[model samples]
Target: MHPATATPTHCPYCALQCGMNLAPGRGESPLAVEERADFPVNRGALCGKGRTAPALLSSRVRLTEPLIRSHATGRLEPATWEEALDTVAEGLDRNRRAHGADAVAVFGGGGLTNEKAYALGKFARVALGTSQIDYNGRFCMSSAAAAHQRAFGLDRGLPFPLADVPRTGCVILVGSNLAETMPPALRYLTELKENGGTLIVVDPRRTRTAEQADLHLAPRPGTDLALALGLLHLVVAEGRTDEEFIAGRTTGWPAARAAAMAHWPEHVERVTGIPVPKLREAVRMFCAPESAMVLTARGPEQQSKGTDTVGAWINLCLATGRAGRPLSGYGCLTGQGNGQGGREHGQKADQLPGYRKLTDPAARAHVAEVWGVDPDTLPGPGRSAYELLDALGTDTGPRALLLMGSNPVVSAPRAGHVEERLRALDFLAVADVVLSETAAMADVVLPVTQWAEETGTTTNLEGRVLLRRRALTPPPGVRSDLDVLHGLAARLGPGQGHPDLEKKFPTDPAEVFAELGRASAGGPADYAGIDYGRIAREDGVFWPCPTPGHPGTPRLFLDRFATEDGRARFVPVEHRAAGEEADAAYPLLLTTGRVVAQYQSGAQTRRVDELNAAAPGPFVEVHPRLAESLGAVEGQPLAVVSRRGRAVAPARITDTIRADTVFMPFHWPGEGRANTLTNPALDPVSRMPEFKVCAVRVETVDAAGRDTTPSTGAETADAAA
Candidate 1:
């Protein structure tokens, strides 16, 4: 590809996968982006993060050389790629010799391309012979994934294309601020309203997306489960359920229905803080529509009861005959760029390629055959993400870790503790394009190529697998992740008693993808028919494409669910409080989320001056009543203390949030790092941490050493300021 020639590709940010044309820079300059209007998902729409993604390619901020920490000086210095790779191998081998193969672990991220995710999983089991491997997607959408698997029999972020949202009669968007997190997607909601359809927004905060809703229900934090059950209760109370649909297309509805009936309108209002009239109105609008949908994001999914909470919402959709039909179903708005694809491949702890269960003998045989390895050699399911991170440095934990593309030091719940675990590791190797907070702690850091500097494939939120073309040459000393994996495999395989590195761990993306396709053949997330050529030719191909001549499946479960009986299963569920709740000691509920200007961990976005200016640092969004009670004023520093830790940020009092709760964005590190105060209580099924809700107490700090209440009222204070 010529430097000036433009190559069509997708954004490097969220899963919307908005298409863009990457115009290579002149001479040694970075790539420039232009809208590629041909892609259906976003058309020509792009968010600020998508537009400014190229800014990260600048050489000044990007890591161009491998770094190894010096033992004597305790500082990182530039080193040859050979030295870094050898050091990593030595450390991993030392740990394996002392402990066992399980003492060496691999941690992956949802941002990695499909090829990388596939290869990383293989490298862990084949080369390192370790069953301990998982990815950050566990924290992203595991709850929604678990719920979907239980309800619809398989998990795809959205069963139908986003294009169908506009045609739906009504949509209940639960726990997502699409306007800020995914700006391009907001247009679909706009179209939904323009088509005379109703939109009900559910959240604890009245976000930008909520402002546009026909009916915005501001519930208390950690009470989304009750709210969902309450809606289903209304459906049954009003005699609005589709008895035919439930009887024919579903099973176990008797138990699920009884569970919903337990959550009456009055009890639900008391739990969720949404008025009874509003709940009734929401039920009326949702059930009245001919076709309706329920979409959930991290809000309801990142909790101690997330899977069941999401199940409650799916039950509501199933009861109303809104699922498995045109423009009607339950879906999840996956956050990360490759979150959908990341979980589909073999990176997840409990899954093989094609979303096959690791514990299944048949699944192990199929994937092992594709990899030219014995089925018995393939390791069984490992620990979940939080569990793996938590066990690090302990007697039962992995002594060495290879982390790629994840900044858990800033992104994990109770991050202060995660950071402590990372520090306790005997050996830590990180591969990334930049020196992230997590990478800064690593013993050896390898510089890897960024988005436009590599060619690979990623599945978007719509299950559309699109190829991201290499538009520019990487800066000197930096290499692609595939190259890094290949180098490590070659060095580790012969010494670690694994098979030939060349055949088992190919560096070429196409070759790896071909092997992945074979491994995925006949599986739930089957991608046997999808190829690089087909994806480029068709713009993108939806998965479950099993054969060459077969067209990809854009919508799933239209004819039948993926379950053995071809019927959706309803899991009975009830509302429960968050893992940690408000009490006398900690009187306010604290929730965390994203800001429009920054992405997760802010490793790349924070380096971009434009985005940093938009959201310089975190601030507490406290309601006026809470601020008054705490004697805190706008722009004044306030300490939010929880049992785990304390995070101090400038106060921004607003009525958008509930008086009994406070909110913070979990993008930055340091004192403003919200995850520091978050609870790590995991959801039993999904293992998702309760990032959405925790108990905390707010204390005002005096500039003049006085603990007196603020003389000015919240009415005169500017929250946005």
Candidate 2:
């Protein structure tokens, strides 16, 4: 029953991880993308980025050689893999000998394959004996991760399967831009809206999703917690609470209810800048008692109070007893391809594999056994990403750092500070597929294979683990991230090599998937009995497939909660202001986000000529009234400055943005990185910086200056500060 020709497939661009088939065409490369129907997430839908992935994959800027920076002249020169690896090993060894294992920190990216992520964490803890490791997932979804673990005992990236969206009655989207970033997933929204289910959206900006909403609540930035609390108050006040569900399957009701009631409609209206009438309407439409769901994304979780904000959404779900029902519950909109899977497998600072906390002794023991190391040998949780960077700036911190697949200089919050720290490092080794801004300052740059050249597993937005197969081999001299780590670990010490490394870290992804399944057996995200053979037999299995004969779980919390008492407890949230606020001195609120033409930090999409031409350079979006007040016109250059730093970009006059605030995309830097003007203040709970809000003042570049419309043939020229 073999097919006539082998089909080439790869995960779609962006975080959805929707699979695609590539049938070779006339004059096309061996791995040309061809969208196919029947993929669970996409169902044949593709976005601008997904359809144009070929240009990105075959970009001319892709790095293919190992680069070594000369310590004396500060110049990067090409080197053989042996020289690069040897230099990196020597630097790491020297760091370990000087400041103990804790002094060496490792930073990972969410874009990496699961095998590479798992290897990075294990490599740091076992071979190098350093617990100072964390990933960029902290900035994207740590709040969601913390809340999901507390409520469901395990965080499913997408707890409910994507297919369940069409059958749902109502959807409450908070802080998610599915319409633009992930246009394919919006099919369910369109279907639900067409079928008469209310589509309520809450965000600071009236995004495309908000514009299509039956009700859109434009709350001030960082006031989401207040609105969520008020919504719960209304649900309880209107007697819409599901007492039967709560009584049968939940705990901690009294405290949660009292706390929610503390913020009434009028109280929250004043604090959140959402009108009382609109707040009442949103709650009334959402408390339908059946087929109601609440979803939160980076909007709520990217603030300084992200954890509390996420907790507010979770508490609202619990108070209304909307959880554990079909088409109902709290859903997190993850930002990376494998952000959920990365957090689940202990890539975060405070967590272990399986969403287990670092302080959990039993979980540590289990993971230690799986890693083939003594439980006591595993160091405690290390510093978070922000804290790690701050530490690097201090004299008594890590002098050497290993960065993989991340461009922190342009991506991190308060990037000016991060750039300073990067320059301060005595030794830095970067492993990536390209020479990113961060790589330009590294002591050693290891050219590593990208997603299309690697085979592994990545859990999608819905916590569905799928196989990511390689259809094309990497260019010569480029190695898989796993192989690079393996080589580095083997050279670390005389006897520090992984015993099962050969069997588990093979080039074939099936073996790695088997090892992951074995480690996950009987655990929270159990996939023990489902191996490559079983998965191939079926199309793709969802998590919790504990045994061979069992069907995968499509939805969670159906019968009972994962807690010991079979109950989901509610955690109350209080309103808090952003870390920075607008005042007379700093009159306008500055916010940052992604443009449809670019992705995060613009590391990949900017390389695509067409997409880059569409969103050429950094620009400040201002309402017409604000532009007039500042003596600015369309295409005019403007200076946006905050307490941290300043950046100059062209001004666009549009009513799409609020008059009191300015919007800018964080994709471009060296010219104008938004992080330069962003607040680095950490969220009290999640430690995520406030990329969403800061106080700033804008000024026109010239008294009679006007903006120039960039043509498709070129990008906007960078303005000299």
Q: Candidate 2: lDDT of 328?
A: 82
| Global lDDT of model 1 | 0.90
Using Cα atoms with residue i matched to residue i, what is each candidate's TM-score against the true structure?
A: 0.97, 0.93
State the TM-score for model 2. 0.93
After TM-score superposition, what is the CA distance of residue 221 in candidate 2 from its true location, in Å? 0.7
Off by over 4 Å in 1: 26-29, 703-721
Cα RMSD (Å) between model 1 and the true structure?
A: 2.8
Would you list the C-alpha lDDT of every candidate in the order shown?
Answer: 0.90, 0.76
Question: What lDDT tens digits, residue by residue, belong to model 2 across residues 415-498?
Answer: 899999988887899998778899988999998877666677777888777766665667788888887877777677553545
TM-score of 1: 0.97
Best by TM-score: 1
Residue 672, model 2: lDDT of 80
* Predicted candidate 1 versus true structure: per-residue lDDT over 478-534, tens digit per residue: 988888888888788777566476467777889889989999999999899989999
Candidate 2, which segments miss by more than 4 Å at Cα? 1-8, 25-30, 495-508, 703-721
Deviation in angstroms for 38 in model 2? 1.9
